[model samples]
Target: MPPVKIVTDSTADLPEELYQRFGISRVPLKVLIESQIYRDGIDITPDEFYTQLRQGKLASTSQPAPGEFASMFEELTKDGSSALCLTLSSQFSGTCQSARLAANMIKEKARVDVIDTRSATWGVGLMAIAACRALSQGKNHDEVKELVDSLILKMRISFLVDSLDYLERGGRIGKAQAFLGSLLSVKPLLSVKDGIVCPTQKVRGKNKGLERLVEIVEQEVGEAPIICAILAGADPEARDILHQKAKERLNCQEIWLGDVGPVIGSHVGPGACGIIYYSL
Candidate 1:
């Protein structure tokens, strides 16, 4: 049997080091600023993206074209290797659709499977890692895919953002007036359910919002050993707060501190802090 290869897009928001360590291949999506497009983690690094954001440059992102995914799919399957292509949530981006289209175009003998994780950032990253672990255990392609799909169902992701300004800028918000009620120094806790983001609760201040995030995760997931936590942000202080709090609550075993990649950070904005973890 050919070696099983795992693939994902840059939006998985996994750290560069972890991606390398796991030998996972990532196809990047592009972030456009004033008509200039930069590939996530390629032309633009996290620090550079944040710097531009700080300098009043609003960045917009685009999904990877089908041709890009087609090329990657062709290359990986060329070596008689089977591939598992995981993508960001279908609702959040077109990346998943592009990958699926590319997979359908494959004519090679090697099999290619595409998975829409229905989650983002580390929520997707954790699923990719789980698939890799199963593959390493000598599991076959279908077996690995099945395991990952099931895991994705039980996965839970909730986070707190410092402000709703980014969402408004990204055109993701349907009505600015809806958030107007909580605009006065309020922080919002958001959760991703079935591939769409929805507001969970609003707190009066940042501290209360942080407390609410931890409380929700613990209560919802309960005590699940096979859980993973990730702190993502462009702001050092915000990211540090998440990292420190996660360690204190989750006890370090289920924790991963990852830089929010450009694709994700573009939507959440700088100084935005959040966590994505699985439930048991």
Candidate 2:
């Protein structure tokens, strides 16, 4: 079997070193702070982006241009490699569409398969990793995509936002709802099902919100193997709490605690925390 390459967008939120280790090629999204724009993860670190966010500096994100995607596809496929490109949820961004367009442009030269992960951060990151695992097992491109589809079916993600302000600003929520929810000290808990974000429930206060998140994970997942908990902003205490709860409730074989980066942090806002995992 020929070697297969794993390609993904920066929104996967996997660490930098893992990309090289796993032979993962990434296309960066743009983060706009006022008039200036920076590349996600590559041009700016997650820490820096979160600092700006916490300081009340509003930042917005943009997907890569067609040319950028074309360039990346050209470089990676220049050696006649077969590629699998995993992308952010189409519901959230147009990155997946851009990737597909680039792949179409290069189809004559190389075999490139693009998939919409219907997730962000490790929600999609785990799917990319699973593809690498399939390729390592000597699966062909078509077979690998089929196997990935199965794994993705069991994947789940849920989030707890500290405030609805950022979501409202991002147009994910209505301003009227945000105001009413804030006044009531309501923390909205959302879930990703079939690639769409749906409000599962709402609770009062951060503690109750976190507990509710863990409970939902426990009930639905019931001892998933790979679990990831991510925290936005610079709150060490919140990260630690999430890490501990994940270990206890999920009994995850490997639990990763990640810092939510600029691309996602900007929309989720400070004190946003969440988990994404799959059952073994």
Best by lDDT: 1
lDDT of 1 by residue, 1-280 (tens): 8888899998887777888888888899999987799989778888888888889988899999888988987887787898999999898888999998888888445578889998888888888888888988899999999998997888887777777788777765433326535766888778878887778877888777777777777776555554666565666676677667766776335677777778888877776677777655
Off by over 4 Å in 2: 174-180, 224-231
Q: Report lDDT per candidate.
A: 0.79, 0.79
Give the C-alpha miss distance for residue 139 in model 1, angstroms: 1.1
lDDT tens per residue, model 2, 39-108? 9988888888877777778888899877788788888878877888888888888899999999898889
TM-score for candidate 1 = 0.93
TM-scores for all candidates: the values are: 0.93, 0.93
Which residue runs does candidate 1 get wrong by more than 4 Å?
A: 174-181
